[model samples]
Target: MLDTQGRNEPDTLNSDTPEQDLPALDIPKHERRVQTVIQDLPVETLCGRISRGALILQPEFQRNFVWNSTKASRLIESLLLNIPIPVVYVAEAAGGKQDVVDGQQRLTSISAFVAGTFPGPSGQKRDFKLSGLQVLNELNGKRFSDLDSATQNLILEATLRVIVIKAESHPDVKFEVFERLNLGAEKLNDQELRNCVYRGRYNTLLAQISQYKPFLDIQGLSAPHNRMADRQLILRFFALQRLTHLHYRGNMKQVMNRELEDHRDPSDAALKHLEELFTRSIDMAWAVFGPRAFRRYQPGTATQPDGMWEERLNFALWDTLLYTFSFYQKSDIIPNADRIYEEFLDVMTYDATFAEYVTSTGDKADRVRYRADTWRRRMDAVVGPPRSDSRTFSRKLKKALFEADSSCAICSQQIQTLDDAEVDHIVHYWRGGQTIPENARLTHRYCNRARGGRED
Candidate 1:
């Protein structure tokens, strides 16, 4: 977890200790270097600035324009009614350009209305029409161009209060201001925040990698998505890989943020290396696991039908397996592809403790360690150990057999000895029974045969 020094330390999972023991954040006070100027500019002036590229309505940090025409209309109605709106914040950029840090939705709405068009998804722009107005009922259903000269003049003359952060401010100070202003507003996920705070070649590379067809297919996602979930997963993979390479042990969130901040401005060679690594790793995963690459697989039993393998990607499994595979040479992987696939399933099915660690422990540091360490060990064993680890009975099945005194489950008769007793699937395999221990029962060889291969 993150420590007082902003570094990660290996975490111990103690059930007795509460997980709420978070390290205190140490924020130092610094001299004020950021200067801000507040001014009320006429809507016409703002629109002119936007048209001239002096105002940046969409920054890398801003989410998509989500307001429907009705919501946009409501803002216009409020403006017409002389109701006060919240102040918009902007960061001053070079060449007299201003990046909209907050109030993007409001500014975009105004800009679209003034331009006589609303921005649509995928770069399609549509005509803007006012609707759902309360006080300005007469103005409802009218386009900006349809308004009379006096009405247009009133709107153009309306002023909006804006606060602009000077260009001379430190980037960190600007990030701090942006974070504080939007903390309670429409919340941007951590990845979205990172994209804004760390905008450079490395961040651009992440976006490009996220759109790669193989990467999207493995993730079960499509390109040009808005929610940023896919980007976050990509970031997660890169962050964990970096941590593992550096042998760093800390909080996942802190590690991700720090890594992005450090690598914001990567060299061309570094970006190319990362791109190749990500592409090759994803391709290998798809080739080996097929569509079920990062899904959870549960061994089925009699009480429950074998839980079919899931199609959804499991983040825990993805991080561990991806990082492990990225370490191997192509020569090592291509020849042993089948062996690696079989070993992965065997590890997932036989290693109960590792499965539990991945499924149960949320994103705790210890859980991350458990998964990575277990996968590493399993990968190493693939080329060395015997293909199968012996057909071992599960603990549950063994306990049941011992309690039954070697009684045949089919006939309920006692068997002579362990050698004569065979473990049978209560629900036959052909009938969709899972090969889990819970589905197994002790039975004599003859009784098992007499029962045939019929479903129970």
Candidate 2:
């Protein structure tokens, strides 16, 4: 039986072995306090464990195997030519269990290469053929091969060394451990981390919404921009059941994961409310058009004389925004959902697409292009500026320095303004500091000249 308090205590469940007794378990109750040990493990055994699902990728765990074709092929070369791989890190779990805490990418890459699958940034590339230590590839259908044999043998002998830790049994414990261990490494964002933790009903819902054609097709949404949006969408659609303005930060993932972990199954009441809202939103999107297809909204100022495409697409955009708002609500439908929905509809109908002109394909096409371009430009406009308001440069600079924790690159002292500081070039203007963000750094007025006005 599971503990009502959800504690992994001895009284919670029955165990056939005394070794399985909760008290006998020497691991720490909280994962954050746990220490890791490095161990050498065989690649074959690791793959076997992963395939059997005995190895659980804690919900907050990240799957970042950044190896491209060349790197992947080298892994195969080492293996085939009989080289040693490095040590692998495995986190010790309860009941004498262990999991790959690090080296997931290396292990995964080795598996992929052996299985004859190599993935790139876009998709799988079948063109990779391992020749000694080098990877031969036909780019644009032209052939290029990897480095030579002694290198191949050297690669193969690479040892697999891993830093292993004991994973805490509970989700909360695991989350805390994940947070601490992932620092300075490529850490998963809150949502992604949340997704890692609660790989249950809520996670499925999130994945569904992420890939949902209507939602995913919306513009200005991509992996980086959508991280927060994705979590917000799931929360609003299922948890809140209504549209909510997104604050975009906070421990949203942790809060939501706790809620889901508590609820073993989807609540009927919540699901019914969500389904109704979903149907209503979708129906309303097309209701303005007619019994047939929906029309695009176009303002009077639009270049097109008359068309419906603009309104249709705007409806789609609004729908996308509304979906995000709904998900942002996080598990309970909000009272303001209807108001938000209506307000967005109004924006789509009037501000975005006025009825003065009919929005056809060409008109809708142009509006979509304009909106995409405009939104990007608007976002970029203030991105470099520190303050949200752009008219005041000094205010913007101050905000950037303070909010971003920016400091003089050379002195490593924080800078607040032009009065005491100035921008210095890493490469002299004669050598090309070029006045770009990368080459420029905040410096004291005297330091700027002393260091040749360079960041370095």
Candidate 3:
């Protein structure tokens, strides 16, 4: 437990902390600044520090774990060889205590190895056979005791280089230090804290819905975290209903709490509402673009940079929703708004074929298409005046053709006629035809040219 300075404040450093009393230590020439391997630090002690209210994983921060156990073991072997290891960072706890910032995995492994907790390969034990001159004893063969004294001495000597950072007064200040130190580094994300807020509330609701007979097969939920971020966005997209500028700082729990408190009681209505929405929207995605195209669009491949899968998926779903809303605006038999939202999620998540299709179109083009379509809609609403320029009319005409379902609006022919299709005004320009949807259609280039339809 953190020893509190006052009843209300937990472990806040006041004026008398050691950081204030001790003069700053200079870096030694031999031990300038390097990570050091420290042995004999008990596993119990380490785990205790981690559990004691330390912000183990900062929100939006993920610990680096690319280095596998082999590298870790090699680090251990280097320590055993009495060679200088790298410098390890240890932050000062509130009352002159310390916590590891970097090298946590190596530290944890050593602790686990000390406690005989590491699963050795091929039924081997957590012991090593060493060959060298005896100092503390030879550290050899399966278990701590098997190591002779010299090896133990080498491990102990390595611990001497550990540089401890004595935290200054105002212990909460450490959080600022932590943030600054990691500002450029990869950080944890908001969705990671779903349980912290909604332990028995919204998250529970989502979990229950997921386990229910119909929802158990949500493959998106089972994907890797990047893909799952896409899943999370799907959930948040519907839950929030506006994606003009979604951010990582928005807490899902707070939103869920607000939504739940508005309800009458603990019921399956909300859960089922979300599931049904995903199912319907996914159906629409399949219907509109074809499932094969959707899969190619799933943005979670290894080739892309880290942490982009979810954002791209979010963008795609938002655009698709815009498309659906626009398409169904004139129809009375439109599916339930809530149901369509959920189906959109399913199309993004479980429908691998749909994911591929979207990926195949490529991310850059999809984004461009979304932006262009949005601009086209805006222009359509604006050009309702008595008159406009030919340039304005021409741009709007091109956009309509681009957004239309078929290349040739009249005969449902493929629009890829390579400069052979011309935008025809439903109302002739000379006949005072306005630049609008009703006045737009696709015609063969030759037909349009022969008709002398160039001027507005």
Give a tens-digit lDDT track for model 2, residues 1-456: 112222233211111112321122223455335555666555555555666766543323345457666666566655655666655556565446555555566776765544445555545466445533443332222212343455433433444666765443456566556555556566544445444445455455455445543333332233322333444344533432221223222232333455656652466685556544554443333332222222234334357655333311232233233333222221111223344334434554654332222222111323433443333333233222112221112434544544465677668876656566665545554232244455555666676667662212
lDDT of each: 0.71, 0.43, 0.40
**lDDT comparison, 1 vs 2, better candidate:** 1
Candidate 3 accuracy as lDDT = 0.40
What is the TM-score of each predicted model, taking all chains together? 0.67, 0.41, 0.35
Score candidate 2 by TM-score against the native. 0.41
Top TM-score hit: 1
lDDT of 1 by residue, 1-456 (tens): 112221212221111112463322223356345679999998999999999989988866567898999999889887888888899988776567888878889989988998999898878998899988888889888989999998888788889999988876655555557667766776554556656656567777877787888777775555634545566667777888877834645445556666776787788899888888888788768777877788878877689866568655676787788888777644345556788888877777889988886566346667678778777777787644322322335656665685767777778878876667777766655334456777788888788778775421
Error of 1 at 437 (Å): 53
Rank by TM-score, descending? Answer: 1, 2, 3
Each candidate: how many clashes?
2, 65, 56
Q: Name the runs in model 1 displaced over 4 angstroms.
A: 1-40, 91-98, 126-132, 140-153, 163-187, 222-224, 300-308, 383-456
